[model samples]
Structures are given as C-alpha cells and as structure tokens.
Target: MSGIILLLQFIAAVIMLPLHILNFLGFWDAIIKKLFPLFYNKLCETYNKSMDEHKRGIFSNISDFSGPSKELRLLEVGCGTGANFKFYPSGCKVTCLDINPNFQKFLSKSQAKNDHLIYERFLLASVDNMTSVADGSMDVVVCTLLACSVPNIPAILKEIQRVLRPGGAFYFIEHVASTDESSWTGFFQKVLNPSWSLIFDRCSLRKTTWKDLENAKFSELNLRHITAPTSVKLIGPHIIGYAVK
Candidate 1:
C-alpha cells in the first residue's frame, strides 16, 4: 500500500512538473493567461505572508525610484499576461510589449471597464528593437520577472535607454543568479538548466545576474538581494532590486 501511494505521488509530481516549468517560463501563457487567472487571482489576492513580505520589502526598495506614476507613460517590456497591471496604480498609462502570442488573450480579457487601470496597451515585439516606440517617449520602463529570460539584454537596455525620456526611471523584478550561496539554487541550476531549456523552449536560470543590470546604461542605481528557502529558492535563486536611470 505504501509503495503504491509513493508511486502515485511520483507520477503526479512528474506530470505537474512540466506544467509548472512551462508556466514559470511563460511558454504556457498562451493558454495559461486566460485559464490560469482564476487560479492566480486567488493566489495573488490571498497572498503568502512570506512572499508578500519579501515582495513588499523588495517593491518598496524599488518604489523609491518610482517617483510618481500618476502622469507617467510606463512601458513594460515582456509583460507576461500583464500580471503586474493589477499591481500598478490606475492613473498611470501602462503599455506592455512582449513577443509571446500567449499573453494576447489576457490582454483582451483585461477590459478594465471598472478597474482603476488606465491606458493599458500591449505590443508584440522584442526589446532588442523597439522601433515602434518613439525616441524619448516613455517616462518609466518596468520589467518584472521578464528580464530573467530576456535574450538580448544589452541591446534591450540600449533600446530602453533610447526610448525612456531623460530622467525617466527603469524598474525591474528579476530572479538573479547567486553570488553568495552555492547550495540549493546553484546546485539545481547546474543540474536542471539543460532540461529546463529543453522543455521551456528558451529560458535560463543561471544566465541572468546583477552584472547584466550593472552593465546596462543606467545610473543612480541601487541593488538588493532577496533569498528564500529550498522550495522557492530552487526556482528563484536571488531576487534583484533595480532602480536606475
């Protein structure tokens, strides 16, 4: 009986594991954006004390550079299904650009009839070349969880700098590679990265780090590190805080 139960548990984990990786990597956004909101709504609404506390700390750290969003034209590169749309104030004009067709459904679903959200738009494009956005047009550039998977970080940063109005800010939330610890995250990254890339199509955990941000053409920046236990840490090694340009 115990053996049977263990076998069933193992089977379930195997099945769910791929779905989770797909979701985390934003590959499933095509289906997940429309379907998973029912699940994500509950999760984000209820909030986990530990994750929220950490997010709050990290978000607050970024908020210092946010200035005021009320009248700003905000651009979000790689807005996966517009998850952070609900997180931002309604007064700001929010624009999202991503190459994922998956998020299009979510974009349509977010009608924003009664919501406080204002001027929310999604563009399907790459950050490496945002020619559609006029030069020095945006007041703020926000990237959440998307920078980790951005393929052309250097070019994207250049585009960001080109589009952002002088004195505009760049804000991001990303899972950074570890500089301190080498236990759970480093170990799992070394082991699972190959498989993760295979299944997720193109996502790398160990590729992104603070160095990417620091190397970008941004000034007046601050960075902070947020760590977690084995479970979350296995997926997210380090959370980065960036407030620059």
Candidate 2:
C-alpha cells in the first residue's frame, strides 16, 4: 500500500509541474485575454450542466429574493468567459463581471436575449473596490473559483456586502485549505500554493479560506472541501462552499 501511494504521488507531481511554471509567468492570463472566445466557448461546452446545477443549488435557499424588482438582479463577479454557465429562470437577470473584459463578447453573443446583460460597459471595477456597482443593487452574487486570486479579499467581501441587497445571496465554489490538518497535506499546500499562484496567474489555494467568508458579515454561511485524484503532482485538496447574505 505504501509503495502504491508513493508511485501515485510521483506521477501526479510530474504532470502539474509544467502548469505551475506557466502560472508563475502569468502566461495564462495573457493568452486568455487576447483570445477570449476560445476560453468562453470551452466553458459553455464543458461546464454547462454541472455549473447550471451548481448555480441552481446555490440559489435554492435564496430563491425568495427572485420576485420582481426592476428585472430580478443577479451579479456574477469574476465571470470568466461565461464558462460553465447555467440558465437562471427568466425574470432573474444576470450581470457578469471579470478581470478580463475580453470575455464579454461571449455573453453578448451567446447569452439568452432576454438577459439584462450588464457587461462592464460602464467602467472597470475590481472586487476590492466596487465603485461601479451601487450599494444594495443586486439580489444575488455568484462567484466560481474566484477570490483565491483576489489581492484584498476583505475589501471584496465588504464590496459584496455593500452591493448586495439586504437578504441577498452570495454563492461560490472555491478551492480552499485542505480539510485534513495533517502534515502531509499541510506541507504540500504550502509548497503548492506559491507555484500554483504563479502558473494560474491569480490562484493560491491558501487565500481561499473559511475565515475570509466568516468575516464578511454574512448571516448564513456554508462551507465544504472538495478533493479530486491527482493526475499531476498537485492534487487532493479543494473546498466548495456557499454563503448567504
């Protein structure tokens, strides 16, 4: 059993090494921003079903806010290429935002015509400072695998609180600190985060934590870690959770 585990670990590391290098160099962002549609289309194809389900599930508890209020407002911060999108019920509109404005074309071209589409035409905004979006302007905020890269997570949370209408919801599925507090996983995460952040350009598993959400003034919060088998050196730790405001 020990031998098998060691062998698996070796194989995983080999695979992730290259990806980590790319992340560190910030190559991924340069590539994605310049060629947005490719990123956009891939997400629509791959994540449509699972993401839709994820979104629907997140909204289950917060569905009460969906009634008419000048076109039901939904804000998806860190929206990337509209990837893995789900069809929210009509009357509930979704406004997507991301670091890269290049992704907007995907929504404009692919999103349902009825969508109230607010695609960052107004101004550039970051999670830390949501000057563009008004306070209490939204019914829901969805963030997917985002926040891990945010430089000022506290500010982002504050912004989320400010923009979200009273009783609104914030849903997310982020990679977080490992559930196993043991040394094996702990050491790897410490080693892996620096490398992963560089390769992915903005991701460091360390930054996405339960404490970040706990501090956000949310009345209700739910958190869970997700794990997947390693195809590479870095694997076996992720957290998926949702928070309700």
Give the winner by TM-score.
1
Residue 87 in model 2: lDDT: 43
**Could you give candidate 2's per-residue lDDT for residues 5-65 as a string of tens digits?**
4565566556677765665587766774566456436744654454455546555654566
Give per-model TM-scores: 0.72, 0.71
For 1-245, candidate 1 gives per-residue lDDT tens digits of 44654565456557668776776787775754455445433433343333555555544532333335437678888765555665555466777788766656665555354266566567879888888999988878877666656677778788888988777877766666666445655655655554454444456667655777778768766677666433455555555465556
lDDT of each: 0.63, 0.64
RMSD of 2: 5.4
Compared with the true structure, the alpha-carbon lDDT of candidate 1 equals: 0.63
Return the TM-score for candidate 1, rounded to 2 decimals: 0.72
| Candidate 2: C-alpha lDDT | 0.64
